[model samples]
Target chain A: MGAEHTHGLHLPGQSTVHRLPAHLKIVSTLAFVLLVVATPREATWPYAVHLAALMLVARTARVPAAYLATRLVVEVPFVVFAVVLPFVATGPRISVLGLSVSEPGLVAAWALLAKGTLGVLAALLLAATTEPRDLLTGLTRLRLPRQLVEIMGFMVRYVEVVTGDLRRMSIALASRGFDARSPRQWPVLATCLGALFVRSYERGERVHLAMLSRGYAGSLPVLDAAPLRVGDLVVAAALPTMAAVGMGAAVLTR
Target chain B: MHVPDGFLDLPTSLATAAVAASAVALSLRGARRELDDRAAPLAGLVATFVFAAQMINFPVAAGTSGHLIGGALAAVLVGPWTATLCLTVVLLVQGLLFADGGLSALGTNITLMGVVGVWTGYAVFRLALAVLPRRIGSVPLAAGIGGFASVPMAALTFAGLFMVGGTAPLDAGSLVAAMASVHTLIGVGEGVLTALVVGSVVAVRPDLVHGARRIRAASIQAAAPAPSSGHRA
Candidate 1:
């Protein structure tokens, strides 16, 4: 389990944002995103303010803007959908560079692009600063159900192993001249997935037996018992509080 | 099917979030019954396996490809309640860690993919299993039917959500038609994947499959001597 998979998006740093407790950072990120979502889409200034604030946090956390921008590729599909909206959306049409586009569609596109980008950036920043295990621990600390947290822990632990199994199976398939080019070849792919499932299920049983041999009852032991500090709460609240203030201002100026 | 933030109105997002949360709560209770000490870890592995399996995309059409949503697959391998929980965990991880889905729209994603996908797929799977032959051979076909229907069902659910709270003013009929048509193609890919996987598992270890448990038990009973005929007063 100590494989190279633990460092998911986490960039090691001693920055203030990175030093903050995981639960605090998680809450802060959630609150910030909620504020971003809650902001009126028509208020362009609020979005600008939100972006600036996120940038400030990124700077403090030492996460490169380029790194954040590169990860935005995940939103490419949504971006494509947003780009198409202006053409297909109904309602008041306006001429843009000789081609008529829907006015409401333009607004919808902007809202999706701006809000979606901010949300992704916020989540990326959280992942960048916090270790994957710490995030799970944070959830546990935040009083998420113990069973759910345990399952998530197992998921994070075994994802790489299962992925390795999938890769090996795919290689085996390819070695046998399987190209999966058309829908007709889906049966082979499905068989691969099936084999993977059986392998994983058997591995699961072995893991359970191993746990039982180690005197494992139902729950895993909690290792991190550190309590939250008051200072951490203040630092965590700063971003969301600023966001709230910015949103209020955006509404007022509107 | 990952709806970004601001695509729907706040009220609708919140409402869906509430529904998603309750569904998860119900799943938690239901999963407890299914996930004994032996199956709990397997349930977790099922989620992880689904996550990895979802990464593998298969071509569905000339220019398009789709991956397994794994609702029916998971519901068949594990139980439906645990399947919902597995999907929710995967979606949670994807949204929070990978930034693949929106935090604000997490509710919508979970509701559409996890709840609707699992329930619809499981319902169809059960229906297929009932109508089809009650044997190990039929498990995969039932699962395939379930998986095939689930994608479009989830798409329809998303279209419905969009109709209620879509930011862009679009014709509902066209939206549903477009979503259904495109997703129907995706559904074919889903069906093939689900069938192959379920069929393989049924071939190797039919006892491990939740959906095929009845078949396994019935086969066992048939193999054993009939107690009613053997026993005497």
Candidate 2:
């Protein structure tokens, strides 16, 4: 919605968390999420520790609690979906707030809620601290396929251009006194997207021709060859390393 | 739906990551055949276009609106392989940048939306096109059918995957019913929109549509043999 702000989730900051290289952050976050998923969902303490670590990172990055909370709203839909488990799941019944819910489903729901929260927050922290371009660079450094990386590069580069076009077209649709508020208006809305698609496709063809003229020989030049420093790796490894410790404890304690 | 982490167990997530990686790799090679040298820029733009297309919010109820999941539309416009690649990038970016889908769940998302969604939609589209007629005008309707079916198919597959690796113990019948039924309704809106959109583009440039390109070629071939008739136009 914020066309002016290209990378919507990223909040600009100068903290040490933001200073970490994106590739390192990407690996660390992935490791954290894997750890979160692999954790014993029944272990209550690990979930709490995971949240604390996430909050600590948010603090270190200087991202506002209010901002992170607002962004965390994306997980609300998953919460809604998980609530149905209690009603549908087959298990011993229990009463909560005068409502009968399955006992096993209740535990499962709690696990889902906890794990989903930690996982989402961990991801949000990375995105909030890193820019989109840096994320791609991180992918490249991690040795994702060259063509895929370049495709992603073009995607990152032209997202604004395409989105700007969409914004303008949306305005044009609004200028005509049309509000897409019901299923009946679907054709009109889709027609707008269709026109957008045609224009974008033509533009793509033109772009290809332009690139061919400019000596783009089916490959983009690779950059970001700087070696990963040991200190930076240690810094990036800190959060995930702590989570790994907590995970080991949780497994051992159980 | 972009399944966030914790919905599926680690084994499931890891398995899906493997599945997603293989599908993306296969699609990358197939797209090279479909696009050749023009693959990089065009597919990238198509990815952005799909990203933009997904921004369309269709009103489902009085207050609720749903976003368009664009496997069929993208496949019909671009080819299926490119659509797969494009959707994968859209998903990867969404995961990395927006935190829209989960980081660990990236493989799951790509598998569902990119592989299941695109291929199911495409298979149905090609089938619909074959069954209905062999003309350009049939492309939109076929695409609509594909779009309509893709959602529920994905939802059904999600139910299956969830059953296999769900962290919770939910009844299979209820799970499938819930996922499939809701997505079936969502599919109606998607189907209509996809049809209208494809119809719009097909009207302007049938040759531009990957689905309709064969019809263009057929029409050209039909005209090619008649030398006298070729002189008239």
Candidate 3:
């Protein structure tokens, strides 16, 4: 969980991209990703266009290119899988640099890398520009289930608290000379997790009691119910619209 | 695990999304019954705890580490219904906030991790509980087995989906074989983590555990007759 907060990826700024409503940003990001997903694997130029658009948004949001590049390590597993595909895939063989690889596998690997990278970039842009709380608020405004939203709000608030608890426990374990580096040490790690869970569950029960005493009902009150503005809608629609046009052209030309 | 977009075709993605939606809807109804006033907050906390737990990577080998998927662990602590919702919440947060998983692949992730992972893990837990000794000690063992089995099951499920609409031309047999083998190793990590967590909770607060409810109920029944007989005598 120490890594969870570190990887939250939000950088504080008041840029116009950051100023946009969370719902608008969410919609725009989803639309952009959908377009990326639907694009044919062979349509390499469309991805280039998508990347350029992402760069423009990133520049507007003042997100560093290096930061975006670093965050992409999350896709390393898929990258590995993509890399291995050409070697293992069964298809017409092609020779590149004296290495014969499956032709279809190469295409698949390219599609995966291109589309996956674009999708991750779009998601990163959204996370970088918007606060987590604001994103939940945006989900709520986007008409996500109230119960789900409430649960998510609680999760966002307490993930760090639990992780803090985990850190202290790890410190305690380390103080006791319990370093879990081997399978033999798994029991100790598990016990720590077990202890952490019990503590969290009890804390949940106590918090519920405290809230109940204060006349808390099933639902928490929503403080902000701001409606989406026309300007926000127009701005949000622009990215999707542009992507759609690109997608349409790509499909028609193909 | 966290499948990126374009791995599966559009039809497969949309289909899995539909399935995930229905599963969540069903879980919502089931969670309503599971989460009473006292339990509602615990459900949220459970999700947060899983979120936190998933962040702590335990070393499985010299170069490999794995974290708790928390499917069986959550289902054992809370009900399976609540566990699914918790996982879904975790996945959503990770996808939206962390950019860890793909937005287009959200449905597929939810289906695999939330639906398949939780249900299969819970099923194995229940099966183990039925066969194992009826002591509180058995809860963790059963959960551990369930947790261990769940990882490979989820991996196989992904392989099945890939067979249907994979964006690549790879042979299905090799994909399944590779996925299952790697995941089996990860499952060992999952099982140990689950057992440790479940055993610890059973030691301290057995009543809070959903999977151990039958054992608690049986214990109460066995204890109830003595007090009532004394009163009658």
Worst 10 residues of 2 chain B by lDDT: B224-233
Residue A110 CA displacement from its true place in model 2, Å: 1.2
lDDT per residue (tens digit) for residues A1-254 in model 3: 34546348888999988989998999899989888889887768888888888898899899999999988988998999899989999999999789999999999999999989999999999999999889988998888788888888877878778888888998898999887786787777777877888888888888888898999988888777577688878878877877787778889989
lDDT of each: 0.86, 0.87, 0.87
Query: Can you tell me the DockQ of model 3?
Result: 0.71
* Clash list (residue pairs), candidate 1: none
Return the clash pairs for model 3, or none: none
- What lDDT is obtained when candidate 1 is compared to the true structure? 0.86
List candidate 1 segments past 4 Å from native: A1-7, B227-233
DockQ of each: 0.60, 0.73, 0.71
Docking class of 1: medium
Candidate 1, number of clashes: 0
lDDT of 2 at B100: 82
DockQ score of candidate 1? Answer: 0.60
True-contact fraction in model 3 equals 0.73
- CAPRI band of model 2? medium
Between prediction 1 and prediction 3, the one with superior lDDT is 3
**Superposition error at A206 for model 3 (Å):** 2.0
Model 2 DockQ vs. reference: 0.73
Whichever of 1 and 3 has more DockQ, that candidate is 3
